[model samples]
Target: MDVCTLGDLIDVVGSPALRLHTASAGTGSPVTEVLLYDAHAPLPHAPGALLLAVGVRAAEAGPLVRAAAEAGMTGVVVRGTDGPAAEAEAHGVALLTVGEDTAWHHVHLMLAAAVDARSAQGAGLGDLFALADAIAAATGGATAVEDPRQRILAYSTVPGQPVDEDRRQGILGLQVPGSVDNSEQVRQVFAAPAPVRLPPLTAADLPRLACAVRAGGEPLGSIWVVDTGTLAPDAEQTLAQGVSTAALLLLRRRAAQELTRHQNADLLRRLLDGAADAATAAHRLGWNAVRVAAFALDSAAGVPDAERTSLRLLDLVRLQCDARYGRHACVLLDGVVYALLPAPEASGGAGGPEARTTADRRHRQLAEDIVGRAGPSLRVPVRAALGAVVSCRDGVTASRADADAVLRLLDDALPVAAVDEIRPRVTLLRLADVMRERGELRAGAWQRVLDADAEYGTEYARTLTAWFGTGCDVASAARQLSVHPNTCRYRLKQIGAQLGIDLDDADERLVLWLQLRVLAEPDAPA
Candidate 1:
C-alpha cells in the first residue's frame, strides 16, 4: 500500500493554520518519512520526508525551504504563526505551521500514531480495504462497507470471486445508483441498530447479512457480506468486531469533514465579499489567479417545504463538489446554498477572456451533471443557476451577483440557466424591482390601464401586455390570449384610444412593457 498522505497528518492535527499552499500539487501526495531539521547541522535530506524546523533565521529559512524541495522532501513544517508564505508557495511544496505551544517531539508522536492507525485495518483505526478483507476472510464470502447514506466506501471479493451485478455496480460507481438504493430493504438496513438478514429481491440476487457500524447514538455506516450455505463458527463475532473498527474510522472521517466544511464556509464568504486581505484569503481559501464561478440551489415548483428541501439538496451539492472539485468552496446563505468553484486546471490559470469562457462552459455542464445525478434523491425538482467566472477578491463579488441574478430569474420558472444567457430577463427583473421601490409601477400609465379595464369590462390591458411581450406580433399575441388575431388588434386599438398613446411610438411601447413586467404576479407566466 502507498504511504499515508500529507492530508492524513493534517486531519490528525486538526488545525486551520496548517493549510496546503495553493501551488502544492495535492494533499494526497504520499509521505514516506518524517524528520526534524537543525539549522547548525547539514539539512536532513530524504525522499518524501516531511521536515519540521524550529527557530531558524529569516535569511536561513528561505534557502533551507528551497533546499528541502530540491532534496525531494515532500513538505516542510515550520514554527511561528507566520513567515515567508510567498516563498514557500512559489516552490510549490506543502508548508505547514504549528502553534507556538506545540513541540516538535509532540508533532512527531502524533504523526507516528496517525500513520500506525492508518496502517492497521482490523484494529479499526483506518484502511477500509484491510477491514473489508478481514471480514471476507472470516465470513468466507464477499464483503462491502457502506455509509448510512448508501455510499459504498470499500469492498472485497471472495477468494474465488463470486460477484453479482449489484455488487459489481456498487464497486464501479462507489455507490449504488438511486434506482437500486431507494428500496425498502435498504431502508430497513438503516432503520434498526442491530444486524439484519435480508432476502434477495429477485432470483438473480443473493441473500445478505448486514450490520450497522455506529459510534455513540448516531449511525455511521454498515458492513455487509454475502450468505452462502453456512458461516464459520466465529464469523458473526468477527463481523461485530469489524463494525467497531469501521465505526471509529467513520467518526474520524466525519469530524475532519465537518471541520473542513466550517472553515471553507467562513473563508468563502469573507474572500468573496472582500472582507479579508488578499494574502490571508489566499492562504486560507488556497487559490490564486484562478477562475472562480458561483452557483445556487433552491426548490422546484409547487414544493411546500421549499426551505427545508433547498437545504437538503444544498448538502448533496456540497458533498458532490467536495468529491469532484478538491479546490472548491461552498456555503449556505439566506435560504440558498452558494458555491465558489475553481475552474479546471486544464484551463490556463490567468484571468483572461478565454479562461472565463472555458470556466463558464464547465460550470454549465457541472450544473447539468449535478441535477441529473442527485436530482432524484431530492424528491422534488430543483432550480439551479450558474454565474460568470472571475478572478478572486472583488471579482468574486461580481460572480456572486451574477449567480444571484440568474437565481432571481429562476424562482419556480426555469430548470437551470446561466447569467449571460439570460441577461435581458435579468436586467428586466432588476429594473422591475427598482421601479416598484420608486412607486413608478403603482401609478402612471399602468395604473390607468388597470383602472380602465376595471371600469369598462375590457381586456385591453391584457392584450396590450401580450402585444408588447410578443414584440407587436398580432398572431403571437392572439395565441397568448387564445383569441383571434382580429380580436387582438381590436383590443390594441381600444387600449391606444383610451390611454391616448400612439401604438407606433417605440418609447410608449417600452414604457408599457416595463409596467407589465413590474405588475406581473409572482406566479404569473413569463
Candidate 2:
C-alpha cells in the first residue's frame, strides 16, 4: 500500500489537501491504518490502508479523525465543501480546501505544485495573487489576494479579473460574496489593521469565494486567501504552504521602505484639526503642563550645529516619548526642547499613555538629562526645564518658562549646557507672577512672601541668598564670601528683621526654600 505525509501529498497533487484517516471497523475495534488515497475521486483505500465511510450528516468530527489518528494513518483527506468536512474537523482533523467544484488530480500532483511555489523567487505578492486567481478559476473556486504586508498592493479574482478601485476603495461596506461566514467573517478581517486570518471562516469552509491584499509582517499586516465554500480535502494544506512565502515577500517590501519613514503622526494631528499644517493650529488646541520623558538620536551627527542637533533630538525624543508619556506638540526656539504633556480633564481619561500616570519628578529629570547628553554629542550645550502639572493652556505657559530657564543657563556654562541646570524655581516664580496677576493667588495672599516688596530688595536678597547657599552653615557662608561667620549670621538676622519674616515657621521655611532655589538660577546673585 502507498502512504504519504501532509507535506508530501501537496507536492504530488498539484492542488491543496488535508490528510485524514479512519478505522475500518466498528467502534473500539482495533483497525490498523495506512495512507496514499486518491483524494480527488474518493476511491477505495489501497489494500493496506484502513477505510471508514460515513453519511454526510454526522456533525461530530473528533471520533472519526481520532480513530484514524490512533490507527497509525499518516493523515486524513476530505472534501471541504460538504458537511463531512466540518464533521472531520470536529473530530480534530485539519481540513484543507482543494477546490469548490471537483478535485482535478491525485495527491501526487498537488504536492509538486506546493514545492515549486516555495522554491521559486521573483514570485512575489503580485505573482501569488495572480496564482490564486488562476488556480481558483481553473479549479472552480473564488477570488484571491496574497498580501503579507498591509500595503494592499495587489489582488486578483478568477483568471483575468482583478479588483478595481471602485470595489476595493469601497470595501468597507461590501460583504464577502463567499458561501462561508460572509458578514461576520468579512467584518473581523477588516477590523484588524494588520494582516491576519479571515474570521467567521471555519474548517468546512470551501473556496466558493476569495479575497486578499499584500502587507508586511512584524506586526503582521498582510493578507492571503483560499477562496471558496467547497474545496477538496487538501485545500487548507495549500494555504498553509503559501503563507510563509507570502509573509516573507511582504516583510521585504516594508523593510525597504523603513528608510523613508518620518513621523507623519503630526500630520494626522493637523488633519484632525481641519488644517494640514498642524503646528499653526496647535495654538488652538488645549496644551497641558504634565511631565514628559524623551530621548533623542540623529540621522547623522558629524559637524552638527548645536541648535540643529537639539531640534533633531527633539524629534527622536518625541517618537519614543510617544510610547511612554504620550503625544505633545514640539516647539524649539533657539536651542531648547519645549513640549506639552496633556492632563486629563477627569479620571479614566482618553489621552495618551502619559495621561495614565500623574506628574512624576523622575520623568522630568530624565528628559532633561537625555537632552543634556545630546548637547555634548552635538558639541552644543543643552539645558532643559520642566514645570509642575498644571491645567490646560498652562502647559503652553510652562513651556515658555522652561525655555527661558534653558536659555538663561546656556550662556553661563562651558559654551554647552546640560539639563540639570533647569531651575523649577524659575517656573514657580513665573507661575506665582501669573497667578497673582490673574487673582488666583488669593488662595494664599498674605502668606506669600512672593508679593513682598522688601523681598525683591537687592542687598537683603544677596545676604539671604549667600546664607542659604551655605546650607544654613554660617562658617561656610562666611568662608565662601571671605567674610567673618558672625557677619554672615548678622546679615541673615538683619534681613529677617527687615523682611519681618520668621525664619523658623513652616510657612516661612517654604518661602525661604523658594527664594533660595531662585537664587541658584544662572546669573542670579550667590
Candidate 3:
C-alpha cells in the first residue's frame, strides 16, 4: 500500500488559510489511514493515521493535539486558529489548518481523493530494472538504483545520454567512489524527501536529479538520473512513480537477502561446530579450495546498538571477502563474528616447511585486507584475530579452535593477532589449557621442582626457565638471570638432586621446561 503525506493533503485541499506548522526535515511522515474527530470525541489510537479535526475550539487545540500525538496519528488537520502549533511541535506531530469557511465535507472529500490517488501511483511495477528503465526513458538520462551506502543494485540497460565519469564508475564497480561519496549534493539528495536537482560541479560536468527511495520515512536507497537538463512536468511525475516503485523493489530485495543470510548462517554454524557434513555445505556454497582460514572479529561491548553495529561490520567484512575470494562464509557466534575463507593454493601441492611459510603469508595478507577495508567504516573499535590455515576436508573444528584461541588474546592494548605469527605464545597458551585438563601432570618431576622452590624459596624454576630460554647455554642463562655461570650450574645440579631427576636426559629437560612454563602463569588462557 502507498502512503499519503500531509504535504499531499495540503497540495490537494489547502487554501491560503492552511499553513504547515511543523517542518518535517527528511521525507515527511507517511500516513496510510485517517480518522475524523471532534475535540470532545473519543481519542482514537490509529497509528499512521491522519486525524481530521472539525469544529475545533482554540482552547481545546492543545489537548487535542496532545491526544493525536499520543494516539500515534501521523498528523492533525484542523480549522479555526493556529491549532496549537507549539503543542504539535513538542509532540513531534505535523499541524495544518484549513480555511474557517471551508465545508467539513469538502475537507474530508479532498483528503480521501488525495489518498486514493496516492494508492494508485507506483502500481504494476514488474522489477527494479523496469523501474530504472522507466525513470531513465522519462527523464532522458542514465539511471541507477543504489542503496543508502551508494552501492549500485541495478541500472537501466539503455543509457539515455552520454555517460559521465561518476555514472560509468558507479555502474562498472557497483559502488560510488569515495570522491563522489563526499559530495554535498549527495548528502542533500539523501536528506530531501522531494527530488533534488544538482547542478554540475564544473562547467564540463553533467547535472543530476536524485530522490530518496523510502518506506514509512525510512530511506531504503536512492534513485538517480544523470545528465537530465531539466525535468519536464511529465518527467517529474515519472520520477515520483519510480521512487515508489524503487522502494517496493528494495524492500523485496532486503527480505530475500535476509532469508539467504539466515540460511547461510545456519549452515556455517553447523560446519564450524563439526555437527554437520562440512564437505556437503562447502559444495553447496561453491567453495572448492583445499584449506580453510578463519578470521574472528572481537565484539565491541559498551557501545550503543552493539549488536546492530557488529552485524553491519559483519556484512562489510563479508562483502570485502567476497570481492577478494569468491567463496567465503560468515556467521555471528558467541557475540563474535567469524569469517571462513577458502584459502586457495596455500600449500602449493607440497605440505612442507615451504607450504607452512606460504600459508602463513597468505593468511596474514587475508587478515590485513579485511582489517584495512572494514576497519575504518566501523563505528565502535573492534579487534581482529586470524587463525591458522587448516585442511578444508577434516579441519573445520580445528580451524575454529585456532581462531578462538587467537581471539582469546584480544585486550585493551592488543587488538589484533594471528596464531601462526605468534606461534610460541600460542603454544604456551594451548599447553596451559591442556595442563588444566590433566591433573596427572602435577605429579611430574618438574612439578616437584616447582613445589620445592615454593617451599624452600629456591631458584630452580627460574633457573630452568632461563636455561631453556637460552637454549641450554649456561653462560647465556647466567647472563639473563644476572648470576655467575657457576651459580647457574650449581642451581641446575640442586634442581636435579632435589627433584630426583636426571639433568642429562633430553626428555627430562623438555618435561621440566614445559612444567615451568605451565606453572609460570598457571591460570587458564582466556
- The model with the greatest TM-score is 3
Which residue runs of candidate 2 sit more than 4 Å off their true CA positions? 1-304, 325-328, 331-333, 346-383, 393-395, 398-424, 427-526
Decide which is better by lDDT, 1 or 2.
1
Candidate 3 lowest-lDDT run of ten: 117-126
Count of clashes in candidate 3? 0
Count of backbone collisions within predicted model 1: 0
Local accuracy of candidate 2 as per-residue lDDT tens digits, 1-526: 1122333222223222333333233122221232334325544433223332232223343454556545444334444434255444444444333333344344324443332332232335456566555545443434344223222444445553333332344233332233344545544554544333442244444323322333431334323444343454555445444445555655654442231122123322222233332232233232423432222232233445655676776765565455455334554433445555554542445664475444344455455555565666556444444444444432334434443444443332332222333455345556555544664433432333334534554344445556666676788878878788787778667656755767667676555655444333345422
What CA RMSD would candidate 1 show?
9.7
Sort all candidates by TM-score, best to worst: 3, 1, 2
- Provide the lowest-lDDT 10-residue window in model 2: 23-32
TM-score of model number 1: 0.52
Candidate scoring better on lDDT of 2 and 3: 3
Q: Give Cα-based local distance difference scores for all models.
A: 0.69, 0.42, 0.70
Evaluate model 1: give its lDDT: 0.69
List model 1 lDDT by residue over 1-526, tens digit each: 3256676556444555354443365776667777777768887668777877766643356776788888888777776656556777778667777666777788877665555544332233347777898889888778999888778887885577465677888889888656663367777877867777787666777777788887777788889887764766777778888899888777766655565566567667665666544454544455654333433444334667767777786777787777767556777777667777775333365666686677667777777776766567766655677766555644667767777777766754466788778887777777766776887455667677777878988887788888887888999999999999999988888777878867788887788767766665443323
Per-residue accuracy of model 3 over 290-361 as CA lDDT, tens digit each: 333444444544666667776777777777766676456688776677777665444555566676667567
Show pairs that collide, candidate 3.
none
